[model samples]
Target: MHPEVAQLIERSHRLGADPTITNYAGGNASCKGAEPDPVTGSDVELLWVKGSGGDLGTLTEAGLAVLRLDRMRALVDVYPGVEREDEMVAAFDFCLHGKGGAAPSIDTAMHGLVDAPHVDHLHPDAGIAFAAAADGEALTKECFGDRVAWVPWRRPGFQLGLDIARIHAEHPEAIGVVLGGHGITAWGATSQECEEHALEIIRACQAYIERNGRPDPFGPVVAGYEPMPPEERRARAAALAPLIRGLASTDRPQVGHYTDSDAVLDFVAREHHPRLAALGTSCPDHFLRTKVRPLVLDLPATAPLAEVEERLRALHAAYRDDYRAYYERYADDATPAMRGADPAIVLVPGVGMFSFGKDKQTARVAGEFYVNAINVMRGAEAISTYRPIEEREKFRIEYWALEEAKLARMPKPKPLATRVAFVTGAGSGIGRAIAERLAAEGACVVVADLNTEAAAEVAKGIGGTDVAVPVSVDVTDEEQVQAALDEAALAFGGVDLVVNNAGLSISRPLLETTTADWDVQHRVMARGSFLVSRAAAAAMIAQGLGGDIIYISSKNGVFAGPNNVAYGAAKADQAHQVRLLAAELGEHGIRVNGINPDGVVRGSGIFASGWGAQRAAVYGVPEEKLGEYYAQRTLLKKEVLPEHVAAAVVALTAGDLAQTTGLHIPVDSGVAAAFLR
Candidate 1:
């Protein structure tokens, strides 16, 4: 390859963010100067470059344009509209007739304006795919190793040159440039070198596309772009800013507002990915920017702006207000989060984007979201298109305490945990209770307690399968655990959630503790937790699905609980083992947390006599009164039940706990809280 061509390829390959306009004609590459190459001082001084509209894949020299570089650059700078464009056309007209009728690229003036020794451009599919991604810059880096400078999406021309100017200022070593949402620009020291670099970059893009691309599955859905009058456009855009901002959100129960793109009208007006907005946000970050989905506005719908806005406003307020109520209900932050900015997403029917933000970060994020949403809306025309996990699931992921802490650097979730989960032992007890909660939120659940009787009963009780399922699993044995998981997978198509909630419990004064009793507790509590956890984890890992594994431990591990050494230690060991297990399996994306509830009594195996029984005796009350007596000692004055513990299990297993890999929720009502008291 020519040295200049080689440089071009290296730079383009280095920048994978450019979205080739396959829908438009491909890119144009050229080198123009007032004079020809100085090879042996030959006076061929002129532009020798790829001709107009040449596909980069199989381009040739015969396709190049030889023009006066300075003239080309100067024209590119002033071409405001048809008049200037006509002037540029005339310059090339002279070059074509006298020099040769080689049609220069549509961007010929653009190429000449840059004043580089060598220049190249191409519409690479890899760059387009990367550009289409939500995290365009980061994805660009991953696809292209190095050599290209990054640029975000912008209209072509002067702004693009300004970008080049910035690149020159920033990186003197830069050989090429990438325009986000556009295409790559490569240049080198010589014509042949620049051509080779352009080809190399195209090949890289082709390779990436071949490796990952699926068929478009549709004929071209490209649409025409007509400019809107600036005065009306700006007036509408400014007027609509607050409305759009209100649409963006980040709270589980949304609180932030964001902007929406008018381009979405073309997308959602169709019968495609627009459906996803009906379901939910495409990605977690979308919630912060677009409020799960856009509140579509269409030109076909004969509605007044005020009426439409007012009606949708209530609709928007309904969602935002509902989300706000939800946030207030579940969130524990010192400062309350806003549900959404306000207006929510709006589609100006056929206009481009009208999304808003507090600043560029927010606005750009909102715009990026509209791009994805619009694309999905387009893609939806092809396949099932877009579907979202439940809103409650989104809330969980958004509000996860640990996940909240990583806001500064975290990207978005990949929808790996978008399915439903059903935990055993939900109800008034831990197992039974988790079921009701996961159900109350959105998960289609199968609540399994030792109650097989309860399992079938709850299934029948919840009715029709839209909601809950009660199953019985003697978690200590491999057979029952497998059966429950199999049934759950069969019912849910897959289990994205798994919480092993069956364990043994028994209490004894230290002197009276027996080996057989210890063996029984370990067999059921420790062994049961292990057997269930192992099977569940294997299924999740093998499915290439990441999930959560939570152990039911007790306060006996660390706190001083007399005569509960075996039970406490085993529970502690369970916690320790899972912590290590979490570390080892972190790359797999599985999370494991333990729960040590100090006061729960569905069937207390280890804590039967120590806490509950002793509390009854100490308080001089009947066993029933022990619940009230213990409630007074905890931080909150509520009786800790199996139900309460179950809620904690659901949180750890749900989408909200993205980074929360190792933790034990102490569900002793206020027992753990009492220490604060």
Candidate 2:
């Protein structure tokens, strides 16, 4: 790789890693270097820029688009002006340097046309504050004088790139320019110089805003909008997340993210919040993720729960109606159809923010982008009135043909995408395998287990909070079960797939099974399944998106076995619960099923906890050979593994068996006694 190109990647990483410098996948960086032409065997200048849909912090060689600078610049002569600038994006492909490393982004022209060795385009809150201000040009001049210039608002495309090139040529002494109602762009003769110039402009703007900014820029907090106490605030957020997620997913299902950060709380509670949010986000990247704006609830956090839910429902309906109208008003013959009328973000006074998307990362990033908008609003209001670009311009960008094309290029979603699964006892054994499998199929999993450390480890291994969250829950305690479900709601909107796998085995004859042993076994297996299923059912019903409930019962539930009286009865209870709930929940589209596996001793938490020794003693076989004994009894002569059970779960939920419910799948490797009659 060229030294300059390597430096460009390093520079992009440094700038992208800081949230204050640029948002996720929001900025682009480029470097111009001479490389040998493959055909001519002569040196040719090439422009290497961050590719479309790539995040800078995690960028690699595959994420940079390589283009021949000469061909890129030659497009200027054929440019059909601003009205036809979008065609330029397609033209960029023709300028590729031996098949571009990555697809060139819309900003490719902006970087290629600029007359500098290195260029950085970023969306820093401080710079956007000036960009979003009503008198942005004057503020830019006030902040950095002639060192950083200002360019008027223009939609990003070939024309805007030309506009910036003109500004750069007109002001040779300027280090960068703040693009009106957008972001900032900087250039330098060297990579280090370019990075330094970008940071200098950003820090300078931040300092100016801080030094000259007024206190309470968002205005004093309103009486009803003051933040709730920490514990109460979190409780409220958890309570509302599912309902909000349901509403947001009206057009299409969305995973949710919750935040009660000081910035969001402060903004939502302030007097000027409604008006500024109504003005919508200023930057294209900001609004693209956040929607045009958020839907803010107009009530206090202390309002009765029922009343709050009622108001939210009404507000959501109005938001959808308004969004549809907005789309209709701006749409022309060539415009892409309105994607969805539902809001991506929702704000409640005193509670903070909830952002939704098709997945957790997207949802989290949407919330982060809204926080950036809040910062921009605060800074702009502190210096001057906040004035974002007009709604028409925002609509143009939001529904751009290029953006639609990009969306079309995205890989098809996984079968379990947008599904949230609550897997109890996911710390180890069959439950852990089930959790991991669900996540791999694209479901967000709540790894609930009594062993908090084990659950945390499993969650971390499955990609941390983005894909799974660990929750400590004693299934026997109804309160803990409820709290675990609440955590699921807060973490990923709500539960739509539930695996009731928490269990224990106490193998003994009826006479030897004391009352204490009987009660303990039933409490953990029968009552535990009941508690988890009941709570999860409520959430799924409320979400109005039908769900799946799988009970990991055992073959002993049906097959008669020696010294298994207590364990068998408890498993029997779970198997019945599956049938009863399946009959009841079908109207609501909730599928309830069961998996029965025999002598899963190898990774079985139940067997490891003394049950295996007792069972082995009863069968007169070595503990290690117990699995072989069980396998010998099976027609398939196979030992049932945890992964086999996990696969059964995937089979039930992954679309093919959508219409099949109230069924018991025996994963006992074809044990005759375990077969369903």
Candidate 3:
């Protein structure tokens, strides 16, 4: 590859990866270079354009489609309007110099027409403020002073490419071009020069914005709204997430919640928030992620669950109807088929913004974009009324065939994608393994533990901050248990699976057992289990989505060992409780089950807290050999690992055991004495 082309690929990725400048699907770049034609063995000018659906941040050689520059330029006359989008794309594909298998960016013609060796384009929020301004051309002059060319907005296609080519021809000395109500473009002899030129234009726009923007008057009003504490707020978000999720889709969608950002609060608190937020996004590119406008929902901060649920249903109906009307108004022969009309974003007055997608990552991406979009809206509103590209333009981009192809290109979702799992005592041991495993299987996880730092670390390790969220929880406290369930709900819409794995053990001869030891054991194992199970069930019921509740039981629950009265009794209570809960909650589709493992001493919380040494002493074996001794005692002579326990939890929640509920899955290496009939 030519050094200049390599430089172009690197520079393009840098601009594409930055959400402040461009999102995952927006922006394009290209470099003109000479390459050996496969058939002729002669150097020919070729355009290395960013491929369709390729993210600039992660662009590689494969992402750069190699197209003959001569062929691209020849299309200037043959370029048809948006109605022939398919044909134009086919022509670009046909011009490929080799079997690269990547489709050239739809903007290849525009890039080819530019005389420079390198070209870069981006949809930076700062630049959008200038491009989408009513006086965008004047702003372009004010910012660049004729150093940059100006081209009015045209629906992006053959005509748009021709017009851009004409602009470049007219302004032969210009460093960049501002496409009014669209995006910005820059060109130079080298890739670095093009990148530098793009940044300079963006900085100029930023300066213009800083000079003309106004101060936010309601800054204190939003700041003073006094949100509920994190736990309560999380609970609220979780409680309300299912209601909103139910309204958003008919396929029993797995909904999650995201409402803890400063930008969200600021936007949601404005007195004119409904009108301002509903106006439109900053650019047409965002239409694919955020829809043309967010669904503005008015729910009081102090509203009860029933009230909130009712409001969500009403608002959902109105929002969908409005979306249908918008589509009906804009649908025409030139547009692609109308896609799903669901609103991806929800704006709550005095609360914050919530973004929904098919899975956790998608939802997070939407939220990140909305956060950036809010700042863009802020920048534009400060200077003048923020005007996005018109609705018709957004409609075209939203339903564009190229954009649909991008969606289709994404990999198929995992089986548990979009599912949310809440696990207790997830800081370490079997709980931690289960959390990690669930996240890997595509379920968003809430890591709840008494160890705050450990829980945080576990969450960070699972899938970064977005996929796994950590919350400090004490299962013995009713309020904390309920709050933790809420946190799980809010973190990922609503919890579809709950793992009750938090427990402790007490072992002593019946005569020596003390009140303190017995109380502690029962408090943690029995009362803790009850509290967590009850709270999680309520949240799941409210979600109106049938889910799973898995209790980590003990083999001792049925086959009690000597000197294990307190621990064994509590474990037994959990087994019976699981059956009762399953029988009662079956009507609501909540399946309750248990996993009984006899001697998973190593790496377990019980073992970590000195239970292994104590139990080894009782068995007349050295602590180092305790694990082997316990394995030898089982029928299969196999070690019961934390991962084995975790597998049972996964099996119960993953729809693999969909028909089998209220049953115990033993992970004790086939302990015949402890096995359930």
Candidate 4:
């Protein structure tokens, strides 16, 4: 890579990783460099800009699109007659340097218009304060004096690029330009120079705010209403997660949730929050991700859970109706086709705030933009009333063919894309395998284990924190179990699948088994299963969406062995618990099932805990051949693998057996001796 191009990538990552300045999906950067032309051996000038549909923080070399400089500049001269958005996009497509990978950013022309070697464009909350205000142009002049130029908000397109080029020509000495109700752009001869100038512009605005007395955002707006304390706010979030997730859909949709961050609380606690939230987002870029306006729900701390769910359903319907009306109100022959508006953020009065995403990372991006919006609006209100770009302009941007194409290009979702799963004892062995499989199938996983380090390792292996979250929990402890359940709700909306797979095997005969060993076995198996089931059931019920609960039992539960006393008894009780819970939860649409597997002890906690040699010696078999000994005894003569057990778990949870529950499925490679009629 050219040195200037490498520097652009590094600086873009820095800005993208910082939530205060930009989000996972927004922002763009570019550098003018020279590369060998594909057709000839000669070097040519190229505009390498960040491409569409990739996160800037983890962007790679392939993510940048290289375009012929002269071709891009020529579009300005012959673009007067082009009115259709698709034709404009085609003009950009035709300018790509031969066989270049990825589509160039929609702002490619805007970057080319600036007469600088390096250009940086970002949406920082501090800088957007000036642009999103009613008196933004005057404030922009006051803060930077003559160092920056001001451009009025225009929909990003060929015309906007031409206007920016004209402004650059008018103010030749300016180092940066602030686009009203959009964002900021900084241009310099070097990458470092551009980044520094961008930061300098933001800090100047922040210093200006510090010098003036900050105005109270909530003083006279809602005088009688008081906000909940931090602890109560968290409690309310936990209780409301299921209802929100259920009201979202009935396809067992995977949903993720986030509580009030500092910026979120600051906005929702204000008395004038309703009026502020009614306005559109500061930038058109965010409209595609978070919609024009959020869905505001007036939930109070005093509302009962049942009543809250009913009210939430009504509010959801109303929000959808309003969205359709708005789309129809502004749409006409000139506007591009639009998609249905889905609510991305939820605001609850006196309780807290919540944001939803298809999965964990997407949900986080939505929250980041909403939080930035709140802060920018607050700053604008401090100077003057915040006035975002009008709704009609946002509608045009939201329905633009280019924006709609991004969503259309996305690959087909995995089978469990919208599901959230909780697995206990997920530090290693069978539980670990099950959790990994769920994540690979696109479900967000919550890894719970008594070993904190092991749980953290599993989470790290999953790659993204939003996709896999780690929490420490001792299953036998009621409080710990309940807390784990709450953690899942707070992290990923609510729980749809619960795997009660946290138990150990103890090989002891009734004649020699000590009370201590027996007690430990029952506590881990019977008691733990009871506590986890109750907590998971409550969450699934509250969502009003039926879910699945799978218990990992043993073949020994049905066919007793000579030395097994406590292990066999506990497994039996656990299986029965599944049937009992299924009977009771059926009215709520929740399914409960169990998996019975035998002799798959290799790599299992049972063998790792020192049962391998002891059990082998009793059967007069070599310790290393214990697994083989058990396999030959099965009807199919095949050893059961951890993956085999994992596949059964997936089948039951995937709704293949949606109408079937209450019975344990065998996964011991055709073990007729342990099969159920």
Ranking by lDDT: 2, 4, 3, 1
RMSD of each: 24.4, 1.1, 3.4, 2.5
On residues 1-677, what C-alpha lDDT tens digit does candidate 3 reach at each position?
77866887779778977787877767888888887888989999988888877778888888888888888787766766656755687788778888854777677767877777888878888887777777778878877887987788866666667777677778877888888777788888888888899898888888888887788822435443445566566656666776666555444464455767877776776665666677787566666777888887676666676876777778777877898899889887866666666678887654566778888667767777777677777767777667777788788778777777767878887767877788888898889989999888888889999999999999998867668999999888999987787666567777778888988876688888898888888888789989988887777777677788899998989986888888899899999989999999999999999999877876787887877877887888998898899899888898888889888888887777788788988889887888687
CA shift of 454, model 2, Å: 1.0
TM-score of each candidate structure, all chains considered together: 0.37, 0.98, 0.89, 0.94
lDDT (tens digit, per residue) of candidate 2 on 1-677: 89998999999989999987899999999999999999999999999999999998989989999999999999999999888899999999999998789999999999999999999999999999999999999999988899999899999999989988988999999999999999999999999999999999999999998899998999998998899999889888888888889899999999999999999999989999989988999999999999998999989878998999999999999998999999999999999999999988899999989999999999999999999999999999999999999999999999999999999999999989999999999999999999999999999999999999999999999996989999999999999999999999989988899999999888888889899999999999999999999999999888888899999999989998998888999999999999999999999999999999888887888789998899999999999999999899899999988999999999999999999899999999888877788
Best by TM-score: 2
Those runs of model 4 whose alpha carbons end farther than 4 Å from true positions after fitting are 80-82, 218-227, 250-254, 299-311, 332-342, 514-516, 655-657
- Those runs of model 2 whose alpha carbons end farther than 4 Å from true positions after fitting are none
Supply the global lDDT for candidate 3: 0.78
How do the candidates rank by TM-score, highest first?
Answer: 2, 4, 3, 1
- Candidate 4 global lDDT: 0.80
Q: Residue-wise lDDT of candidate 4 within 1-677, one digit each (tens)?
A: 88888998898888788876766767788889888887796998888888887667877778988788888888767776537434666687888887766787677777877768888888887778888889889988988888988889977766666777787778878888888888888888898899998888878877776665267743353432345677777777788887787765543364756757666665665667888888857776666667888877665555676777678888888877888899999888866654555577777766656677677777777777787888788788887678999988888788877776777888888877878899998888888888889898888899999999988998889867788999999999999998899899888888989998898876767888999889888998899989999999999988877888999998878877779898889999998998899999999999999999886777676777778777887788998898898889888888887778888889998766778889899988777768786
Top candidate when judged by lDDT against the true structure: 2
